[model samples]
Target: MPVVRLCEDMKEHPKTSKHKCPVQIISLDDQGGLALANEALSQCLEQGDVGDAPVCLISIIGEQRRGKSFLMTCLLRQLQNQEDKDASWMGSDDEPLEGFEWRSGPETVTKGVWMWGEPLWVQVPQGKVAVFLVDTEGSMDLQRQLETSIKLSVFSILLSSYQIFNILSEFKLVDQDYLEMFITVAEEVGKNFNLYPVQHLDLLIRDWQHTSTYGVEGGQEHLKRVIKDLESLPGNDLVLKVLKAAETQCYLMPHPGTRFTRSNRLGDFEKDFQDCLKDYVTTLVALPAKHVRKDSNGHALTGKQLAMKIRDFFQFLEENHYDFSSPVKMAETLANMREQVNRKIVDIIKGEYSEFVLHQDRDTQTETHCLNISPTEMQKKLEEKCQELLERCRRELLGDEQQKEAMVQDVGQELRQMLEGFMSTYNWRFKEMENAANRTIKDKFKQQYKGYITDQGRENKARLQCCRVQPRKMRQCLEKKGQELLQQCEEELRGAGDRKQAVLRDLEQELTEQMDDFLSNLE
Candidate 1:
C-alpha cells in the first residue's frame, strides 16, 4: 500500500497501491472543484470501508502559514498511537504511510478542504468510531475577499464534528467576524439542514505567551478569557448560546521550532509537542461522532447523507444570497416539505381505501343474505375494515406534530367521505333488492289467481256459488297475503337502511378516535 495526498493531482496517485491513495480529494476552484471534491469524497468513503462504525470528522482552520496542516498531522499520529501500539509507519513493501508535510516557511501550501486517505478506527469511551481528518485552507488571504473567507469558514464549521482553530496567538478581526457569522446562521440551520453532532470548537493556541495580567490559571484560562471576550461583544447572544465556553475545549502548545525537522515526518517532531499533543488527540478520540440529523429513532445518518446535506446547503446559500438567518426562506422550505407529505398522505389514503372498498363491497353482499343481520354486526365489520385503513393512513404522516395532525385529519375526512359514498350505493342496492322481492310476490299472486279461475270453471254445475262467493273470497284472501308480503319487504329494506346508517356512524366515530390517538402519539 502507498499513501496518496488529497487535494493533489489525480495522476500522481500511486497506481500500484490497493490499500492507500493519500492524495488531495478536492482543490476548490471556480469551475468544477466542488463537483470533483464531491466525487472524490464519495470515492474515498467507498475505499475506506468504514463498515458499521460511526464516522467523526475533525478539521482545522486558522490564519494562513500557521502550521494548521502540521497540527493535523500531529493529531493524526497521536491518535494512531492510541489506536494500535505496534502499528508500523511503513505500509506494504516499505511504502510511506506518514501524514501531511510541514516546512519552515511563511507561505500557504494546503488549499481548500482536504481529507485523509483512510479513516482511523479508534475506541472512544462511548464506542469505536471511524475518524476522518480534514485540513482546510488557512484564512486571511490577500488573494481572497472577506466574503470568500466567511463562506469557507462556515462550510468547515458545518462539515466537521470537531474543529481545531489553530491560532498562532489570538483571534484576528477576521476570525471574530467569521465566528459571529457562524453564530447568526446556526440558528436557522435546523429549519433547512440536518445540523448534526452539535459541532465542537477547540481553540489550540500555539507559540503560547501570557498577554493577560489575569493569566493566573495559565493558557487554558487565557483561552477561556479570549472566548469570553468574543462572546461579550455586541450582538453575541446567539453565538454564546450555540458556542458556549463550557462546550468549547481549549488546549495550549509550544511551537515545534528548531527542535522539529522540516521534513514533516512523524519521527522528527519535537517530543514536547508530541507529549502535549497526545492528550489533545486523546480528548478528540473520547468525543463521540455526530449525525447530521437529530435522530428521533435509534439509527443515525450515514456519510452519504452528510455529503448530500453539504451539497444542498451550498445550493440553498447560492439561491438565497447566503441569507443564513432568513425566517421567510426557512418557512418556505418547511411549507414545501409539508406540501409534499400532504400529497403523499392523499395518495396513500386513495390506494389503501380503494382496496378496502373492494373487499368491503364483497363482504356486504355476502352479509346481506342474512335476513336478521343486526346493525351491531354491520358496525363491527365496518369498524374492523375502517380501523385497518386508518392505521395505514397514520403511518403516512410525516414532519412535526402539527403537520402530522393536519395530515391525519385530511385522511380521516377523506375516508369518511368514501364511507358515505359506499353507504349511498348500498342504499340503492337495497332498493333494487326490495323491487325484485315485490315483483316475485306479484308473479306468485298471478299464478294463484289463474289456479282459482281454473277450479271455478271445472265446477260449472255450482256456477253461482263458485263464480260469486268462492271467487270473491279467494280474491280477498290473495290481496291480504300480497299486502303482508309487501309489508315484510318494506320492513327488511328499512332494517337494511338502519344497518347501513349504523355502519356509517361507526366508521365516522372510529376515524375521529384514530385521528386523536395518532396525534397524541406525535406528542
Candidate 2:
C-alpha cells in the first residue's frame, strides 16, 4: 500500500530541530507502477483560501544521490522564514536543514514525488500567491527501472512552473539527452492540454571546481560553452533547440565544505556556501510574479485550477493505460480526446444560444400589449444578447490560438445569421401591425370630425330660422359662421393626430376639405 506519512508521525533527527515534513504525493507500488496519493495531494493543494489563490510550483530533478532533496530542504527553510517574517531567511549558524529527508549516503531516499504539506503564502505586487515545493525521485538510478525514471521525470516537468535541473559538478552530454527526452514529451502533452510546456528552467551546478568563478556569472559562462560544444556535434539539434526556446538560467555553487558533506548538516555549510545559498534562495522567492504558473493564454492558474489539471492528467493516463514509454501513442490518444471535447463544447454553446432566443421569443409573445418598439431597437437588443453569449463561449473554450479563433469565428457567424433571420421576420410583422393601427385611428378621426361638422351646421340653421332674416342675408350669415366653426374644429382635431404623426398629414387635409364642403352646403 502507498504510505502517506502524517506530519506528526514524521521522524525528526536527534541533532536537528524539528520542522514540517513533506508528504508523498505520488507513490510507487512494489511493482514500480505509479499511484497518486489522492488524499495527501488534495490536502496539500486544495484547502482553504490557498486553494483558490494563484499558485507557483518549484520542482527539482536530477541524478540520484546528488543532494536534490537537500537543496529542496534549503528552499523550504527560506520560504518558512519569509512566511514567519524572520530577521533573516538564513537561520542560525547551527540550524540543521529540516524538510525533505536527506542524509549522507549513496542510497536514494525519495522514491516518488513528494510535496510540502503546507503551502507558503507570499504577498507580492500582483497579490498573494501560494508556492508549492515538489521533490521528485532522482533520475538515472541504477536500481530503478528505466520506465520508472521516465514517468517520474515527465510528471515533474508537467507539474512544475519553475524546474531546477540539479547537476553534481558540470553539465554533461547524458544530462542534455535526458532533458531533451523529458521536455519533448512534456511539450507534446502541453499541446493537447492547453498549457505551457515549460515556463522557467534553472540549471543548478553544485560543487564547482573553479575558485574564482561562482554563482550566476560562472553558470552563464559554463552554459554558453556547453551550448557551443553541442553545436559543434551532430545529432544534438533537438536538445539545443529546446534549451534555446525555453526561458533558462544557470546557478553555480561551491561545495558546502568537506565537513558539511561528511556530516550532511546545515550548520556545517562553509561560510561562502551559506552566503551564496542565501542569495540564491532570496532571489528565487522574491520574484514570485515571474514564476506564477499560467495556462496557454497566459492566465495565471489558481491552486484549485492547477490541482484539477494535475488530476485530469493522471486520470487520462490511467484511463488510457499509459505505459509511460511511448510519447507518440500518448499524443495520438490526446489528439482524439481533444477533438471530442471541442465538438462537445461547440454543441453546448450552440444549444445555449438557441435556448436564449427561445426564451426571448416566448417573453415577447406573452406580453399583453405590443412593445411599440422599432425594428432598429429590437435589432440592437438582439445583437447585445448574442454578443454576451459569444463572450461566455470564448471564456469556456480550450485550445490553441488558431483553433480557438476558428471555433469563435464559426460560432459568431452562426449567431449573427440567427439574429438576422429573427430581425427580418420581426420587422415584417411590426410593419403589418403598424399599418393596421394607423388605418383604424384614421377612420375614427374622420367619423369624429364629420359628426362635429354636422352638429355645427344644424345649430346654425336653427338660429337663422329663429332670427326670421331675409334668405340672401341668412345665407351670408350662415357661410361666415360656418367658416369660423370649421377653423375651430381643425385646431381641435390637429392635436389628436400628434400620437400618429406618420398619417397625420394626409388625415388632416381630407378632414379639412370635407368640413369646408359641409359648411358651404348649409349656406
RMSD of each: 13.7, 6.2
Tens-place lDDT digits, model 2, residues 249-312: 7889888898987875567888778777877887888877788888777998887787787677
lDDT of 1 at 383: 60
How well does candidate 2 match the true structure in TM-score terms? 0.79
lDDT of 1: 0.54
Each prediction's whole-model lDDT (CA): 0.54, 0.72
User: For model 1, what is the error of residue 391's alpha carbon versus the real structure, in angstroms, after optimal superposition?
Assistant: 13
Number of colliding residue pairs in model 2: 0
Q: What is the TM-score of each candidate against the true structure?
A: 0.58, 0.79
* Model 1 ranges off by over 4 Å: 1-21, 30-33, 51-53, 83-97, 123-128, 138-142, 154-158, 184-190, 211-220, 227-232, 258-272, 288-299, 310-523
Top TM-score model: 2
Tens-digit lDDT track of model 1 for 396-463: 44454455667677777777777777766765665555445434544454454445444534554355
Ten contiguous residues with the weakest lDDT in model 1: 1-10
